[model samples]
Target: MMRIVTAGYSRHTRSYYSNQAHGLKYFLVRLQTEGFCQALVNGTLYTIRPGDLLLCKPGDSYELMVQLGSNEPPSGDYFLSVELNEWMLEWWEDYKQEVKLNVGVDEMLISIWRHLVYEKRRVKDSNPDIMDYLCRSILLHMNRLISGGVSSNPYERSVSNQIKMFIEKNATEPITLRDVSTAVGLSVSRASQLFKEAFNQSVMDYAIEVRLSIAKERILIGGSTLQEVSFLCGFANYTHFNRSFRLRYGMSPSEYRRQVRPQ
Candidate 1:
């Protein structure tokens, strides 16, 4: 399961830094809105300017040395930070090692960051609802930034991910590829293509796999009849469930349950 931790925005600046560094305990991401910050990332000096973003991992040593412009105020720089979940940390580590952000800054993401920070500032004392919305917006923006040139692939993966989440949430209800596709704004054919590309199976095939797995678990518990387990796992009727069970397991659901469960 994935989880999201603390998320917020802040704008601050420092000047003429003495040589100092903190033992990084969280992923540090800074979107520079104005001015610049000289950072020592992995012992390399990177001069980050406006519209630039810096990505840092936990325990990575870095120091910030901001250079204020002559026209810029004494404290003109701004940044935002969010502590990452463990899964997020693992994803970042993989990204840093593989994906190169060596290209010039992306203006679109910077604009998104600016809008998010402004939105965050607007409802400081009240509006928890708006804050929650802003967090989701930020997440989507970051995902777009990281997705790179794979236009249709991300859409495919997103659809599949949404379907899996929905299936897990509504395991006891009947579901179909058409249902999942409509839920994520795609046609059944497109959803099937995407799901096959990502998961190596058709949507209905995957759904049946999930259903049968759930049915097997229920049967082993010995509380429900085979028909009842089939219904609970979202099969339409007893014969259909029995046919699927025989095709997959080479035996009826009852026989499999009897073989697995102690007398």
Candidate 2:
């Protein structure tokens, strides 16, 4: 179980500074969702921007400064102060938490945080279990976003990664090239070109690969028939799914499942 001490949104129009030189008392997770600011992270002051995530453990020196120049947008962020239990501690130790990570402002991740914030605001009526699960979901999703590889060109890398993440999250649903493009605010041709340049595979191909991977897992897990697996994994029909699976694995879905499963 995890306990959230405080969770809310903050926006600074002028200038603001939060200094905790003596260190913090609880785990702090902050996501910069709009504009930009500066923060002392790992003994160095860093310019934090939208899509930047800040993770701080207890007793870590944390400082945030928001300096707004004339005609500049205000700094905005979502923050949560958490008290970790045993399970949360285990999850924390499993990953090397950096002072700051550029995990891109993923909508799904923000949605989870928003829900957690709303539940926390419920005060006396807040359900502990719901808050706990929502917090865990945010952390887990952040982990995945942070694990993605970054390229040399920051702008290109961010756009390419946004496309990849969108495909991954929606692969099980009916997605198209236009859908991918719209999600990342890029034209269809541009999105396709960028994805191929970054990943060496076309967007549609990667989507098919993701779909087949899901289909394979469903086949191995049983309970779902081949046709059902195909449909559930976003395949238009069993024939198309069979063809794609065989092309990727060199065996029919049923054959692969049989060989991998017990006799």
Candidate 3:
């Protein structure tokens, strides 16, 4: 699993410098949020402004330089020291000596980072896992920024893709084991076994989940009545839709809509 050894946010004024560089012991990320910042990444000087990030491996030398913006008291930056899992390390190895990511100052990433710093100080919060999730999110977002797209895990990509596509495309209509099996070029028994192994649920059960998901979107949109929702989501009868919805979400369709409505 991925790990964030430590993280913090800080600010600096003009004329601050560190002549001696610490020996690299952890993967480091320093992101500038305001004003101007600079760093020598892999022996090249870079002037990083708001939303620019610096990434370094375990053995690379790094240094920070910051200049305050006009009307701003100090330059702002956030730092993270991380321990990547084996797969993540392998992913990192594919990059060059130094990489710069331009994420462009996202609010969600800022919110997540603030919460992570708050949780780090509250030792009794009993929610340490939030930091791990947030750190992973930041790293993934940086990867997206650098790579120019999102990437999926290879193991997850290899599992029951054809069956899932068929279910999503046909969830509004009647679907069957024979149809799915034929589409995937597998016998019905073999298809059933493979789907179960990959998704831990039978094909029909996943189909219901997909259908219910569609119904939920429609319900939340509030452009349809309960009767329309039942038929539109592929339920044979309104009573069956009500029962299945209650079983999965513990509320009637109408009740769910009300609960999720904006206050």
- The models' CA-based lDDT, in order, is 0.63, 0.85, 0.73
Compute each candidate's TM-score over C-alphas: 0.52, 0.79, 0.53
Candidate 2: which stretches are off by over 4 Å?
A: 41-43, 88-97, 150-154, 168-175, 187-190, 197-200, 213-238, 253-263
Clashing pairs in 3: none
lDDT of 1 by residue, 1-263 (tens): 22223334444444556343665666666655555567787678887665455777667777877665556554233344446565455556546762113212344445555665666566446455554555455546665545533334434444556665556556668877778878768888886776677667667777777888889999988888888998889999999899988999999998998799968
Report the C-alpha lDDT of model 3 over 14-129, residue by residue, as the tens digit.
64554325546678777888777678756778887777777777777777766555565677888888775675587677665556766555555676787777876776763657
Model 2: how far residue 235 lies from native, Å: 4.1
**Which number leads on lDDT?**
2
Question: Where does model 3 exceed 4 Å of error?
Answer: 19-22, 67-73, 146-263
Which 10 successive residues of model 3 have the least lDDT summed?
149-158
Error (Å) of candidate 2 at residue 261 is 12
